[model samples]
Target chain A: MKLRRIQAIAVKEALQIVRDPRSLMIALLVPLMQMVIFGYGVNLDIRHIPLCVLDHENGQQSRNLVARFAASNYFSLRRAAGSDREVAQALDEGDCGIALVIPADFSQRLNDGGRATVQALLDGTDSNTANIAAGYAKSVVAAFSAAAQLDAVQRRGGTLQTQTPVGVEARVWFNEALESRNFIVPGIVALVMAIVGAQLTSLTIAREWERGTMELLVSTPVQPMELMIGKLLPYFAVGLADAAICLGLAVFWFEVPFHGTVATLLFTSSLFLTVVLCIGYLVSVSIRSQVGASQVALLATMLPTTLLSGFSFPIEQMPAAVQAATFLVSARYYVEILKAVFLKGAGVVELAVPILCLALYAAVVVVLAARAFRKTLD
Target chain B: MTPSAPIVEAREVSKRFGALVAVDRLSFAVPPGEIFGLVGPDGAGKTTTMRMLAGVMRPDGGQIVADGVDVLAHPEQAKRHISYMPQRFGLYEDLTVDENIRFYADLFDVPRDVRETRAAAMLAASDMLPFRKRLAGQLSGGMKQKLGLTCALVHTPKVVLLDEPTTGVDPLSRREFWQILYGLRAEGVALVISTAYLDEAERCDRLALLHGGRMVHCDTPAGLKARMPGAMLEVVSPEPRRARDALAGQPGVRGVLLIGIGLHVHVDAAGRSAGIAAALAAAGVPVSEIAEVAPSIEDLFVALLDNAETPA
Candidate 1:
């Protein structure tokens, strides 16, 4: 309740951080580096897929189809071979992510007006990118088939017309370019906030408990609420700094647009940080051992933020049970807010639910922390 | 309207952890401005009892009234009256002396101007003023304990709960630490200190002897010593442990304890020391000397515990 007491504890905690260089590095530098690493590393928007080919039908028709694959930047010709083993080897070693094979009787079939099927092999380990690559490859092959039909019709001296009355066109909004860097950078920022806010407060408070400093603090007339608030403030600032670092790198180095107002992002980010810090404090207060507290915080915050938050994996695409579990994960809502504000340029009206979720998370965690901290000397 | 009350009172306090009983139905009271000591060996429930009184732990069954407030029902308000230093006293190792002091003052909600002046006086009083700017982590063990005490006392609480505050420090620092506690007592502060050192218990106005979650005895250290059931004889022998086994619970002998390489035998006051020595000699236990001596607090503790162990 008292501001001065809270300020004093916050200042002392901040001083401890400043005194330890390793903690500072983990708090500030690690988040920025993670943003950049994840920004480049996790790409959902597949492009320029290296596609090797085994074109046994080396006739004019096959050569034209190869040219068509080259024209579409989706598939780059990495190798042209007759050996199935060599192409298979390329796919196995991941040297090429996708491969295409044309049958030996490709030109003869086309001349006879028969349908010739081309086999497309793709690496399905990374299902998202692989799925996108397979779609693009199929579309390019379909274009080649249509062009062949047109050529045949022109040679017959006939005007060609098809009756397809209606069709649907899919347009991607917000990130028209579908840049992977744009979508993942905001999630990395959320992860960084979770790590910084939770890990620091959890370790520091639990260390105090282990070393017997908490007993000293408790014996004093300092109110429990004042002590709890004071402990959270410095880490909240650190969380803010981590957020700034993530946004800076995302905007400056990766060129991801922050289309929404900075105020909204910072406000929401602060609320999320408070939630994490309170969770950390609660863990520290109840556990009493530094190692146990740190482990709890790491497991509770980091794992959920990574796996259940829809940060890298889409929660919608997950199983029904997992979708239900994500409701309890505060990071899921924050990640949605971060992505929306950064990419979709969503305002308060659109982000109110996530914001309210964060506020509620902060309130619940803080209350639990205070409750756990109320104890006796003996 | 009422007469001055005792500074602290606990009635039938007991704490249980699963099946293990830590502090049995314990009851005690400390009059105003007096030093009350909880003296017991390891696992005697000294720390647990102190923690309950400090309002850090809830008793499974009991009432702890400190400074006219129920510790269990009104912990936050009770916390305002007592300063508790756990065994470690949890000092901020990385923070400077002045910073650690200021931190506790702030935590206690001490006013700003009062904190500055009080912190200065505490440092001066403890002779820690010279190292005000030095990090607590870098200070010697004794200095850290001093700093911890200063922080605990910064808010001027009515009662101070010190849980083995001098467990690990060197002898010189232990003396200095006790001196500080003495000074606090001089200021009309009620002191409840738990210690394993019997000599330190002698300094308290009254002492509570606890063992196996039970209060073996509660009185002044001297009174506890005087109540030793028999005359204590210092026995010099070649084998102290062997002599202890031979003299222990022998007819007319109440207890046998090892003090250094010598055994102290508590015997019936009217019994003959020479006769006991002769019996030891007959038993092939070599005895160099046997002389009657006053019972120490530890001697009394060993006697009381030995008596409690035997079928009465």
Candidate 2:
């Protein structure tokens, strides 16, 4: 493989991207747009759930209980229901996600030292949000029960203790606030690199085939490896630039921390970019049409990266078949690396598995792309 | 002109795409400084044969040697000795004419100093210097073809293969394009050009006529014309179609072809023209004039195709 031949192809490709405004926009502006959209638009943290109250007993105790539910930021009181039937109607109409019904004997039973239960109705249509809302309701009720028990102990002339025996303390590492944005922004970097490196590289060779330049190029003394490397160099630069922009936005703009060294981030990103760009070249060489290549790139990179990479959904929670399939997506490993470097402060030694996976992916894809390209020339 | 060793040779070259034989047992030799034309109609496997010789594609069977190098076994090395321009010559529409030329030069590893001088000469010869800064997409069809030829020849390869370089260009551009080709020939470069136009075949030193992926005839234009089966007599009639019908399958008449405003009937002997005229006249088809004439390349091709279709 001659360096001059590779340089010639690289220079020509760079000129094409620069001269064509559409390609430039795809390489630069699209990533920025995706950063803003994915950073703010898709929030998994559900809030401001509407609540309806059906208070049959209009007593102070019932009102106090209603205020407790209203105080928390997670639930907003939409309206009051006249009866149980009205509460059921509200839940059925989808007007409120949570409904609290206080029984008529709630105040009497509590004054007599007898236990009283309030029925909490919840809508389970959107199961993810509904499950979170249910968890919040259970916590509130548990806190109220503990407070009542403490009052009973204090009135009996005994000291009340707030701490329970054998209490478990849960601490979240890296993301103290558990802000989804901190986790999501890093994954977005992997996604952006995949699109810029693979999608753009996929179109390069296919465009040459469409324009009839491949025949002319093949007729020269240039080898297949030279052509593949030359075509990948420019797009790899674009992918790196896109990764940098996303990382910058995630760190400064979105306030996500970058705990690892810059070298580690660059190294991992380079390996991932190589893998994706080789996949793009393979698709272009096999399909040999611009339209077909673009479609294949979109399907092969974007959808799988977003859905199957455990970016938004945890791989552990996915079905076994899906968990096994995630191994096939290069972004899955890259996402792990990005999250590790940006949030966990992990170095190469601590993150060897993902690094090895990415390197292996890069090596295999490059070999396959070279072989496919040689076949195409023949 | 003195004969020289063959710069390009193909032995029993064949290509198959599944069930279809694109090129069947094709063989040809092109000497240095000669223009060899591959003449055929659409789907006649002209492109396939040219591709195999240029080393862009390998033949399914046979040997292709270019400049003493076996192209099939060592295509990359063989590529240095030849240049190929496909029907669509892969010009970068986004790049300027000068940029396009420089790119090919760089790919071919032409020295910087040599590229500068050679590119200047090519642009000057093709009258493209004024439009060097223009984008390739903005150039006229003819100018694009000229630029393609210039880029292909910038490295000064020993052989050049052009596939239908003048298919869609206007008549004037076509003439100018051929003039540049002649200039290359004068520089001792071997050219293998495929064209559908028989008139272009007349310009080559020797031409091969392909039909249905098989070579039917290969000879110089004059030699192929000399191989016409029988004497041709031009018949001018007020109703030429009626006269062709009257002469069809007539005794001593080998074939009847309708040329514009007349019919050229091939008779087995020159003495049989009077019998043909008498036969047409007896069939109530009046002939204004009749005379023996020499056969054109078109006439010979038509006759060859007729013979191929209905074999004796």
Candidate 3:
């Protein structure tokens, strides 16, 4: 492959890109837009859940218990219901995500130093938020009960150890609060690479065919390898710039912590970019129409990266067969690397497997893409 | 036709598309400094022949050689010496004409000094110097074709294969394109041009008349016209259509073609003019003028195709 031919193609492609500034601007900005949208939109933290309380006792102890639930951040007490009928009506009318009900003897039972039972009713429609809200509610009630038990112990002057015999201390390392944003924002970088890289390069060869320029292009002395490299070099650089922007948004804008070294990040991201760009090139050569090629590129790259790359769903939660299939998706390794680098302070040693897998995938697809273009019209 | 070796030659090359033969056993040789024309109607394998010569299409049989390179075995090697312009638009529309020319010069690895002089000369000859900064997409059809030729010839390849370079161009542009081609010929560049306009074939050093993917006649413009077995006579009549009707199957009449000027009647020999006059009189069609004329390549094309269609 002659460098002159490759340079010629690259120069022409650069002119084409510079001549149409709108598409380049869009390609660069779409990733940042997606990052912002996904960072704020796919938030997993469910806060300020509306709660309705039905207290039949109307006593001090019952009021204190209601105040405990209201003080927590997870629940926002909407309104107090009067009776059993009101409680049922509140739950039916979707007035609250969850409801708390206390019986008429609740103050008496608690004052007599005996056990008191209350009912916590929850909405099951939005199961994810409902589940999280249930956990939050349980923690609140548990804390309140512990305080009540300690008070009784102090009243009897019993040993403090008897109040809490066995308790486990849990510490979360990566995400201190186990925030889902950490999980979400890092994966957005992988998605941006998969989507924009493939979308832009997918139109290269197919556009030439659609515009009736490939015939003359192939008639030259340019080899397929030279042409592929020359056509893809500009887009590959664009993809890396896109990666930089998305990474900046993740770290500087959204404040997702990044712990990996810049070298490893760039190297691995370049590998991933190579894979997606090659995939787009292969599709462009196979499909002659730009519309068809871009659609197939989205299907082949964006869909897999979004759905099967463990971006939204955890790969460990997937079935065994699907987990095995995730191995084939190039973005899966990138997602793993993203999570590791962002959350675990993982460097090269901790990320050898994913890096190797991405490199191998890049190598194979590059070969396929290079071999895909033949000079013959047939 | 030259004493020296052929710079580009095809030996019995054939190309087929499934059940249809696009080019059948076509053979020709183009020496340096000659313009070889592939003259035929649409679907007569003109484009296919040009493509094979360009090394873009692989022949089903036989071989093509360009500048000591086996085109079938190594198209890339052959492409160094061959510049092909497709029948359709073959330029990047988003780029300016100058940029397009520079891009081709880069592709062909032309030196800066050579490219600068050559590109400027070509643009001046084609009257495209002022429009060099214009985007290729914004140019007129004829101008686009001219830019395509400039780009194709920028590399100064040994053999230039142009497929209907003026198919959709205006008549004036077509004449200009031919002038540029004559300039290339003067520079000793071998040109293989394909066109459906038989009148354009008159300018070629030699012509190949293709019909149904086969070369029915291959010779000079005058040589191919000389192959017509009968004489062509122009008849101007008051009722030309009726005269054509009366002379449809007259003896010694080969073909009757209605033209804008008059009816072009082909007779077997000069002596058969009396028979045509008598036939028109019997049908009560008054012939205002009757004159004998030399057959064009178009006339020879029709006559040869008719002969090929019939049995001995």
lDDT of 3 at B179: 93
Q: Candidate 1's residue-wise lDDT over A159-223, tens digit each?
A: 88632368568888888877777888788878877876788788866777777677666655567
Local distance difference test, each candidate: 0.83, 0.87, 0.88
Per-residue lDDT over A1-378 for candidate 2, one digit per residue giving the tens place of the 0 to 100 score: 789999998998889888988777778888888888888886877777999999999898888778888998789999899987888899999999999988999988877779989988899999888999999988877777677667767887879676688976889999888888888888888887787677878888888878888888888888889888988988888888888888888899998988999999988988998999899899998888899998898788999999999898899999999999999999999999989998989999999999999899899999999988762355
Write the candidate numbers in order of decreasing DockQ. 3, 2, 1
Local accuracy of candidate 3 as per-residue lDDT tens digits, A197-284:
8998999999998899999998988889999999999898889899999999988998887777888788889988999999999999
Q: Compared with the true structure, what per-residue lDDT tens digits does model 2 show for residues B220-309?
A: 998998887888899988898999898888998878889886898888777888898889989999888999999877888888877887
Alpha carbon lDDT of residue A265, candidate 1?
A: 82
Q: Please compute DockQ, using alpha carbons, for every candidate against the native two-chain complex.
A: 0.53, 0.64, 0.83
Q: Which portions of model 2 show Cα errors greater than 4 Å?
A: A146-169, A319-321, A375-378, B1-3, B236-239, B279-288
Q: Model 1 Cα displacement at B222 (Å)?
A: 3.9
**Local lDDT at A196 for model 3:** 86
True contacts kept of each: 0.85, 0.87, 0.92
